[model samples]
Target chain A: MIKRTISSIALALGLAVATIPALASEGEGLAPAGTNIRDQASLQRGAKLFFNYCVGCHSLKYVRYSRLASDLGLSEEEVMTNLNFTGAKFGEPVISHMPADDAKTWFGKDPPDLSLEARAKGVDFIFNYLNSFYLDPTRPVGWNNTVFPNASMPNPLWELQGLQTAVHGEAAPGQEAVVEKLQISTPGRMSPEEFRGATRDLTAFLEYAAEPAALERQSIGVWVILFLAGLTFLLYLLKHEYWKDVHESH
Target chain B: MANVFSRIGDWVNERAPNLAPTYRKHMTEYFAPKNFNLWYYFGSLALLVLVNQIVTGIFLTMNYKTSALEAFNSVEYIMRDVEWGWLIRYMHSTGASLFFVVVFLHMFRGIMYGSFKRPRELVWILGMLIFLVLMAEAFMGYVLPWGNMSFWGAKVIISLFGTIPYIGGSLVEWIMGDFLPADATLNRFFALHVIALPLVLLLLVVLHLAALHEVGSNNPDGVDVKHGPKGNKWNPEKPIDAIPFHPYYTVKDLVGVGFFLTIAAFIIFFAPTFGGWFLEHDNFTPANNLVTPSHIKPSWYFTPFYAILRMIPSFFGTAIWGVIGMFGAILLLALLPWIDKGEVRSVRYRGLGFRIALGVLVFSFLALGLVGAGVTAEVIPEWFPGADVTTWENAFGRLMVLGYFGFFVFVWVYTRFGFEKTKPVPERVTMHD
Candidate 1:
């Protein structure tokens, strides 16, 4: 009967483990994100870049500027001097002064707030999107993306990445030219490898923005498991003393 | 100090003579059959899990936000800012999953030994009521996170009420307290999850134990140790086959609890989400009313019935029948005490037909659950994975759902003809070896 119960427990545990199944990735053109959320230095650099460029248009409504000090390991004074652009208070949400209605009319739509964007679109999607922009003659901004077709926003990092041109394949009959590949027509100050690293940093920062506790959770988890192990050993000895009769009789 | 404690004890004893007697009756003197098996461990463990949930749940409410707008961020806040909040949240979430696992095994024990058989019918009924309340409690609690899955899972379930022809739309509106599931829905669910269902659940659990104590425990042998002719058969004052639950079973139960906690710690600390089984990845994203996820699955515990709900073709015109089918799967368990016509109690005494049916039922139920978790989730889910069995999955799902119902029918058939076969019931308790 103990064997039956043991086997049953094993079977249930097996089934419980089976429950998650493997996850299938969603979304297209999502190049694998090569960023680690644990990379604090990269995240700090990403915050600097975000303050310089993305904050002028896109706002991170959910993040607090104050949180960056503790999370990204920046000093409050450093954050104020380096990253604070709108002269806001330390505890304020990362909001931009650009009015939504005016920006919407100017750009065909207001630049969406990016508080939950990293989570909404995965890290891979954001990473690839940063690298996918290219020049298109017919578009309003003279820019387009293979990742996101006819994107209204011009290349936000075009200067750092330089201008990219889509090399097209021969058209089939009346069809439009298929962009077979991308080429950097004009090189920016940063090399392709450097730009990739920069984008990786940005992706890491966004990933942390999505779940700031990701790094600490697993580390703290080790101690929690250890504590439970100690408790189990204490309980087991007490239980052993009580079960002396049952084992002897059986 | 001893004299003072004795005076207080005397004062309590004078006020209530039944206190010590009741304690002795239920705890010290309760005569459980000595040959009880490892399957008996879960009943107390279930109680332990229940206590863990209630305690952790109370702490969670201190920090949790009940509004849909703030709920998602608030969970993250708890996970991040609150002291040891992640640990508490994990314990609660993991406790919910463990609660079902513990209860299911306890239920299986009852089935194996026919604990639901004669003289203990009320205990079974009360237990069944507790199970129903637990489902409701879990359902309400699942929505409190207010993530994409929580919002949409609640939406899909509440929309089931809207399937009721004329009053359906109004019923759903009234339940939601708005046009759709939003702040009002989250708030109401919060109240019910924390207060109403738990209140009823505690009461039912109490009743379940009280009723169980009145009849004493059924053992693996399914023999009544309480009654028999003294000296000639078995003692009436104290059955020779029975042992006191306190020193014997209490210690045994503690060991079970230790094992349970070890497994629970493994889940809570290491895999809090249980790899998307306990917590879905979609739930990490905040709820969006405008966009629907391509695939929506219920929490792992509820998936078996959800699969049944989806498997039924809605050719009967309205979806009301499918809704009925989903609920009927659970409601059928309440009838188990009366459904089986078998004279014998233990599965050991039952013929092969009954065992075969029991085996199939377990298989079908598990198959349905595995399928519902998203077909063959055990395998890696790549789009072009070679094991893709999209069509086969649908067919397999349909068959398993049918087999779930067929098991009960098979029970009705086997009980009619099958006669008991077992080694003679010993007058004194005997070990299997």
Candidate 2:
């Protein structure tokens, strides 16, 4: 019974460990964002895009300008010169210039801070939501999202990605038509491939903004594991040496 | 140098003479059974995790805001602005989950080795009290972050108290100090999580170790080491199969600590969220009382009991039955030392009836954990297309709950009657490589 129990436990533990990486990539039937925070160039590009487009109404309130400067390999001067459009200090968080009342008047609700959006909803949700925007006359805003159904705000980067229209599926007797696919009606500044890459970069930046420690965590984790492994090996030797008395006793 | 240290030690010892003897009693002279196996690692590991929690908790409290409005942002502040604050926060969060993991394994070891039997029953009772207190601590600590899940989870759990017969509604209101889990609830939970419960937990741990030492440690063989052949290297009165805890087990436990810390560090650094099990995704959002999370569940550790509460149907227009069943499940486990009446201490010498009974209990517990975590809810629909998910889940979950309680009844009847066959009892502890 003991042996069987131990083996069963071992099997359970093994299965759990195997599922960790698989779970990290889980998303809700959306195209994978495939964002890498380690890619400094992509993160920098995403940071620029966020400041130029998203930062007018939305804020990354938990993210500091100095942190962006350091993690994205840009200098304080560079960040202030290019990305600090709100006239905040270098150490202050990235707040939008738009007032909450003004935002509520414009969008019918205040746009939420995007500081933890990539975490609350995964990077894939952000990427797919950005890409899923389509022109809809039925909504209060001129745009609608297939991923989010009826989001309050219009597409902040609509000019860059151009105008998209929904391809509706066949409706049942009393049901509304489902968005089967999204098609670009008019091309914007960037082509289909470029827009995808741009969205991917923006997704990567938001992912980093969500947890800035992630960049440092992965690098430091390697060294921490190595040090503990060394300590464990030495302790194993010491334990082995001390247990000889018990082995020799009988 | 040695002479000066000895004189300093002597001066302190003269002032507090019992301290040296007490230290010797628990450390250098305490004789633990030499045949202890892999399961023995968890007790010391649990102590290590407790220290981890306390130290990290202190640092977290230094920056953590107690109000509902600032609590979420303060945690983010800790992660972003404070120097090495992310590490401290991760350690505490990871430590909370790992504490339950280590403790559950420790309790399982006690059951497997029959360490809760006979003279060690007080030790088991003290340990159970610690377990109960730890659950309260973990639940309260989880709500301190003031995330959407934390707010909803607190509201859901505190409302469970509202199922009492007469004062249920008032009781919940009293517990929360408001109609809902608001600033008042957060403040009180912070106080209890930080100050009150930890003190109780510490006292229980000391008493548990004291009681265990009074009766001595139990081994895998479940043979009474004190009743065996006498005379070891240091003490003639001690059993032949016993060894001092200081150099033997202390060094042994050190190795276990090293290995345990390695895994802990891996999780803390690489996967602090443990794929949303340790930290839920919805918890990233600040608490909004107006909007609740789409899919709300408690932490993974509470799922089995949570599943039980959901599985049992409420009767007589009151949900109190499910509440009673949830609390009853934990009560029955705590009453295990008195439940099994079998004379055999080790499963090695126990009959097939007891073995099967224990097997049923373990299997059912794991299955119920799955049900509680909503793993079966997602999987059942995928595995059997067009199946009614609620009906299927409830049927499977209800059976598992029965098996969970039935183990207690089965073991008691099987042993109370002379249905159990016996094997020859060993005179001394036996070691396996």
Candidate 3:
């Protein structure tokens, strides 16, 4: 009976632990980003893409160029010559040259800094948002996203991924057409598979930008945990040795 | 080298004559119950985590910017620019979460073995005060980050004061020093979090340990070792079933600390955010007064009480009752010593009713935490298709709330009406490896 009671209590506690993470999820079916921050090659590719395409409007204000160079395994000269477009100092953060006031006038909102976007919204959300842009005649920017509908900014990577038009499902009377899927109307320089990979690389870079220490912490953690486990084993032996007195007396 | 150390020790002992004796009284000479089980590890572990929080918090504050405008960016600066700052910051965050983890388990042990009965009531009361102050400290420390969740969480919690009858609006404004949580609030919270509350927590912890040492520890079997058959090797007056706390428990607690730090290091290094439970994802964004998060809930530690506040419906044109229910939940736990008035201390000897009631309380507390976290809101629709989500949540949540409060009532009735059929307790503490 006592054993039964303990099992029941454990079951209840397990149920409680299992339920809390359910809040972290959303109903929207986001595609997997398949991005790895650990891949230096992927991160380098992402950095190149971000500098070329996204840096025109968005900023990575928290990510410093010097730190980026070190983390991405690039020399200062290579990063400065190839990736640094705005002539920012090596120690300076990646701030866009596009004036905030101008951005506000053009887009009706200032394009947000993308430094912490990957942290705020998961990498999957960024990947899907980048992929979901479609041509829309009614939108002011002539572009709309299915992931983040009515987004103000036009597709910045339109040259690479090409133009997409929404395949609308049947709508009821007086209702707007529901987007079933995005169909590529105009293919760009890259193939469909290549574009997806490019977007994943960009997402991976942003993820790294969000928390640069992720590259270091995991490596350091292994040694720390190993040391602690060893110490715990030794302490357990000492505790057992000391407890002999109590056991002997008993 | 030994002679020099002895001389220095003697010098200090001459100035402070009670030092060595006090150490002996608390450590080497102090006798603890021999049969302390796994539940006993949490007390020492809580102390270890407290030290971790204090040490890490000091390093964090050295670089942390307290003002609302600078705080969020400054945290990022620390994460990126400051050398090894991410480790310190993660340790503090992970320590804060783990503090509650160990403390909750410690409190559960107290309840399970009846550590708060009679002689140890003062110890329990002091512990409850520590819990209260620790909650305040944590809330203030959270707001110092100036993250979006921090801003909104501060607003929602402080607005609980707005449920006051007449002074509601003014009290909230007085607390924030503004209409909303802003620079003034952040500065004040930083002051309280760093300086004022930690001092109180430290004082209460010292007093709690002093009180426990005075009364001696309660064992798993709940036998009063002091009054049992006496006479040990150390002293004729000492309980036979007791051992010196230093060599025995000191070594034992070292093992516990090692295991604990292993888990803590795992969290601080690899999974510092604990998948948004420890350091929330919304908190990554800078605070914006213009927009509110879609979901605003307190940290996981506060969720059970937050659920209690939510589950208690507004009555008589006032939401004050809900606020009352929230505070009352904690107040009830603090008053456990009085509510559970029985000769039989441990659950091992306690009647079946007591056991079932305590189990229900544990289940309810954990379930209520899930409710407060807004998990049920997301889950109810998925589980029961076409169901009125709010209605389903409210019904289930309110029942859990009842179960939480009902434990105190049921225990009172069971003990008062002699419904308890306590087994005969052993004169000596039953020992096991």
Give the alpha-carbon lDDT of every model. 0.81, 0.90, 0.90
Model 1: which residue pairs collide? A21-B377
Tens digit of per-residue lDDT, candidate 2, span A49-158: 99999999899999999999999999999999999998999999999888899888888999899999998988998999999899999999888998898999798888
Backbone-clash count (model 1): 1
Residue lDDT tens for model 2, B136-244: 9999999999999999999999999999989999999999999999999999999999999999999999999999999999988889999999999879999999999
Q: After superposition, how far is residue A240 of candidate 1 from its true place, in Å?
A: 1.7
lDDT (tens digit, per residue) of candidate 3 on A10-56: 67547745753674454258888989999999999999999999999
Those runs of model 3 whose alpha carbons end farther than 4 Å from true positions after fitting are A1-17
How well is each residue in A10-53 modelled by candidate 1, as lDDT tens digits? Answer: 88778665544444344544778888877789999889888887
lDDT (C-alpha) at residue B309 in model 1:
84
Listed in order, the DockQ scores are: 0.35, 0.62, 0.62
Candidate 1 DockQ, CA atoms:
0.35
DockQ versus reference, model 3: 0.62
iRMSD, all candidates? 4.3, 2.6, 2.8
Q: Runs in model 2 with CA error above 4 Å?
A: A1-6, A15-26
lDDT (Cα, 0-100) at B300 in candidate 3:
89
